[model samples]
Target: MSEIQTVPESRRFLSALGPGLAGALSVTLIHEGARRVLSHPPRMDVLGKRSLKKGLRWFGVRPSHGRRLHRQALVGDIISNSLFYALVALGRPRRPYLRGVLLGTLAGVGAVLLPPFLGLGRSPRRAKRSTALLTVAWYLLGGLSAARATRTV
Candidate 1:
């Protein structure tokens, strides 16, 4: 009985991964699209690279120049989304889709406010108005996608 249960549980965990990947990719696509239209500042890839570079610096490890920064950024972004929905999968939301919207809004707002508190960089309030709004929209969409993905599973 336990072996049978373990198989489905493992499968469920694997299934949850797709939604997370979708969510992350969706956010990236939307962000780029919005940037093209609205001219928002700070490419997410650059921000990811900066964050990763700073992290590596802390450990006395230096990253290579220019090349693979985008790849590194992509991997980091995907991992963050994966980890986030992994929690949702385990938490077993009664209404995953609805929960996703709520979570996304909270997360979007948190993202805007967190930089100063976390000391990552300047808050979006200092950024261009379009940039601030687009950033929040992308984050919200990511959450929606993640939730929708899981629901399909």
Candidate 2:
């Protein structure tokens, strides 16, 4: 009698990582494109640079624009996307579209309200409603993509 060996849950989760990354990159692309089309100032890269700058400041290192900025943004996307999809996968939503919408709505709400509260003083809420909608839509698309992608995993 031979017993079957199963892979660890962590290994299983690792299988889902690529999909999460794809979802994040896709969201960034969609979001940036919308922002450009709407003539809104680029915001995503700024978020990454802001965090990186704060971290570097503690080390007495000054951050700059261009490469460092882009790299940081990509890294942020990877971390955030991985986390989001991991949660979704673990939660095992019955309907991905519904789950995506719910998750996206929460993220959108945060994007709209948190910046100002964080002392960044950005007025997402006060800004034109369409801008907020665009942000939410982008996030929604990401969630939807991630959920669908993870279905294979």
Candidate 3:
């Protein structure tokens, strides 16, 4: 009989990092590209900027302004999204699509519902139904990307 092998938590997280980053970058590329082409793309960047500024203030640091603020927000978004997607590493290696769906759904719902409570702004749903839905889909895409990238690593 063959014994199943289990990876250490730290190793799992480390192994997941590259895939997580790939997922995050994919989402950003898609989102930014859509923003350029679509007349009404999801403006999640606004929320990200607001959230980052608020976080910095809470930490007694001043936030940047103009293009610099936007750049900072983009970086922050990638790092955060990577960490969130990395949670999938805790699950079994098989059925990555299922794991992706679950993680993506959770993040999607939170993106639409949690902003107001967090003082970031109103929910994305309040702006436009299509945009809100697209926002969710974007995260879903990220999840799937991370899941697929895991196979290569």
Best by TM-score: 3
- Show model 2 residue runs off by greater than 4 Å: 1-7
Model 1's alpha-carbon lDDT is 0.70
Error of 1 at 21 (Å): 1.2
Clashing pairs in 1: none
Per-model TM against the reference: 0.79, 0.78, 0.92
- Candidate lDDT (C-alpha), each: 0.70, 0.68, 0.87
RMSD, every candidate, angstroms: 3.1, 3.0, 1.9
Enumerate residue pairs that collide in model 2: none
For model 3, how does the per-residue alpha-carbon lDDT over 6-97 read when each residue is reduced to its tens digit?
87879989988888888789888888889889988887788899999999999999999999999999999899999988876557788777
| Candidate 3 minimal-lDDT segment of 10 residues | 87-96
Each candidate: how many clashes? 0, 0, 0
Which pairs of residues collide in candidate 3? none
Question: Between 2 and 3, whose TM-score is larger?
Answer: 3
Full ranking by lDDT:
3, 1, 2
lDDT of 2: 0.68
Give the least accurate 10-residue stretch of model 2, judged by summed lDDT. Answer: 85-94
TM-score of 3: 0.92
